[model samples]
Target: MSQNLGLRLCLVVLLCLSGCNAFNGGSTETASITPAGVPTDDPNATRGLAPGLTNHGVVDSIALGDAHEAVLSNTSFTIHGKTTVKYSNGTLRRQGERTARVVNPRDRRYINVSIYTQNKIRSDQKSTNNSFWSNGERVLVALSSSQTNSTTYQHFESRDPQYPILKYHPQKERYYTLFQAVDTKVINHTTNNGTTLYRLTSTEIADSAQLIEYSMNVKIAQNPRNLTFHAVIDSRGVVHEYRLAYTATLTETNPSTSVRVVSTTRYTKMGSTTVDRPSWYAKANNTTPEPPTTYS
Candidate 1:
């Protein structure tokens, strides 16, 4: 394949894998869960639990830890990361930091982050939603605006203009909507060493309820396949804790060989929590109980 075509194909695959919808904004919302063989809640009790843990029948909250660890063939990549999540007051606060090393590509590395609150930005920008800068250079700008007469939040941004903008709609289940995209199909699914494997693909964007949404292409051919099931958690219903099993796939183009590559990233018990923040404004105020670390 020509270098240009190869680049296009690589971009498409990346889009499908990550669901990179840069233009759409999103907010944390509640999701219902029904795991089988679990005990139903007892209405008489003031508290409840998710069946596997403690006997606190009047349970008001629960917590859990999750990790994504994987190994892959056909590519050389190493991912190291951890995430912390707390749920309460009908909201979820998640913070995480990840760093990856590419042995092939260009011998370069970058840090990726996702913090639940707007605390990641400046105070002024926090309210209206603003850009994230490094050393006075605006690397990313996020706008938190709403669609007319709708409960949904629309986030549109050029986090890195060199890459396309992203849009995320939490209310719609359209995890990511990528515009002007491209694709490459390599391994169906495979793992190496002790890591777990997960793969994702994207179909053309579909219009749902008059809103545009993209369907995610996901594959799990490893021991912890359950870990990759795009879980939407509603802690209020489950009782004491919220548990997450997340598995993500990443592919990088070999600048020299231009080979399309993949990896199986892995981990266990990456995050858990017993606290929650009501709103971004409240979190900003620092009125809530002190989390081990204060971002804003």
Candidate 2:
């Protein structure tokens, strides 16, 4: 009788473990658009922004409360854009374009992003067709299950850390914290195709300690140079474009060289984009799942 009871207990524990796996496992549903305007394949579809909401309304809501959290939680959209980074001498160092979908406005972890390089490459060589997605716990590459560091994931997930790829999703806390040591202002405004654009600018003087906190690879002298920012927002309160210009003295090598770097990004295709789940996700549902550490 004791042996039979022990067997029953083991079976019960196995059943509970199976249930937990089913709950935490990544989904494998086919991507489908519903009549209700929700994308069925999106894990966060049930938590998406209200249907037919306008950019203007989103902006007003953000301004009325916690700007970053409110905008991130209440806005959902698709955006595609290009980013160019140049050296102080105006030489282009890198340029790339990315397309992304945010099915759930409140949580950036539910986003899907695809990226490509602008420079032409040989067909035989693998092109930069990088893709990323988040499965609730953390971000993962579309075809792989390996975990990615937050900073690296944030780089491709949002592209520009200073100005997240989400048009209205500002990094308010980071901005405010940095601004305490800098000067910022609304430099100007312009109108185009019924949309008004406001330009905001900021400048900061920093030392090695401040630069280190930002995770920069290079070292700089005390009171190095200046770091400047310029962002343009549309009438509906969406960021149309942003640029960051930084100058500092390098401390990594001899002679302590001064360097300047500039990065610029532009956003487009805001409200009408959708991303399909990867094919592997569907396959995983029918078969035994590989360990989470597995990579494609």
Candidate 3:
């Protein structure tokens, strides 16, 4: 594979292993508040929350039926975010921004994603753009080449569910097992519309053993470091924002290299957004469809 492709693959793998998202631009009304029915001083208060808690009965008792369902049941939503990766010495390596739109009505699901990388900008006012579209089991992807000013399309039948979207559903056992809340706090947040939301903050960590159990391919020079996650869930059980960060040394090379990656995702205007079929779908053919590639 080419160097650029290799680097892209590595980044994709890293972001997948580290759960990512956090909303920005929300107003903060108060520094802290205590959640009802849960003791702030007790570290075990969040023992049965989805995405962390193992006790099913306790999860049902909470105001939020299922944290993931709020996201899954919505017919339309949009996620815009950026991820940055840095080397051991704090030098920038790779950075990219991604936007995804998901529309699910009845049993049919549609998703469109566009990713832009900072490294592939050309002087001719051209740039590399990779995009993906999926409708249920059918998938189409387009990769633009700066050198040729042409785009290549790959169509295929995807038996595996689309990622990041599929991964966002916290009801899945694998997804739930990836996080354990270490701290729970409440904060008063005011939205742009002046609506105040009682947000519960959960600080979570996933250790090396948990990562291995999840079958995440993470290479580390020494013991794997824990992945830190912070989420802000409103009183209504909606996860308005989430952020993930991790740093580790890779031992696969002769001399280990240290790497750090951080990503943030936000959800807004839920239940009102719309995602339509891509215009390029009409031009795609599946005669020699290639396997789908996952990018976070």
Runs with alpha carbons beyond 4 Å of true place in candidate 1: 1-9, 19-38, 41-160, 165-173, 176-296
Candidate 2 weakest ten by summed lDDT: 16-25
What are the per-residue Cα lDDT tens digits for candidate 1 across 1-296? Answer: 25324333433433333222221112222222223322235353233222211222211111211110111111233333323322223232222322333222211212232323323245221111212121111122222322122221112122322322111101122111111111111112223243222122222212221111121232311111112112211222211111123222212212211111121122111222111222332222323322121223
Q: Which stretches of model 2 miss by more than 4 angstroms?
A: 1-65, 78-99, 105-130, 135-170, 190-196, 202-228, 234-240, 265-267, 278-296
Q: How does candidate 2 fare on TM-score?
A: 0.46
- Model 2 RMSD to the real structure? 17.6
How big is the RMSD of model 1? 21.2
> Backbone collision count in every prediction?
36, 2, 4
RMSD of each: 21.2, 17.6, 7.4
Give the per-residue lDDT of model 2 (tens digit) for 108-161.
Answer: 432332222223244221123334444433333432111222221221222222
- What's the lDDT for all of these models? 0.23, 0.37, 0.48
Q: In model 1, how many backbone clashes occur?
A: 36
Highest-scoring model, lDDT: 3
**Candidate 3 lDDT over residue span 1-296, tens digit each:** 26336435644543444332222323312223344444445567556344422222113323343554555565566655455556678866545454556666522334333333334234222235566666656766566656477877666677342333433332334334433312334433344343234444443333455544332344443344555555555434555555556565656646877667565556554677665667777665544665566756
User: Top model by TM-score, which number?
Assistant: 3
Worst 10 residues of 3 by lDDT: 52-61
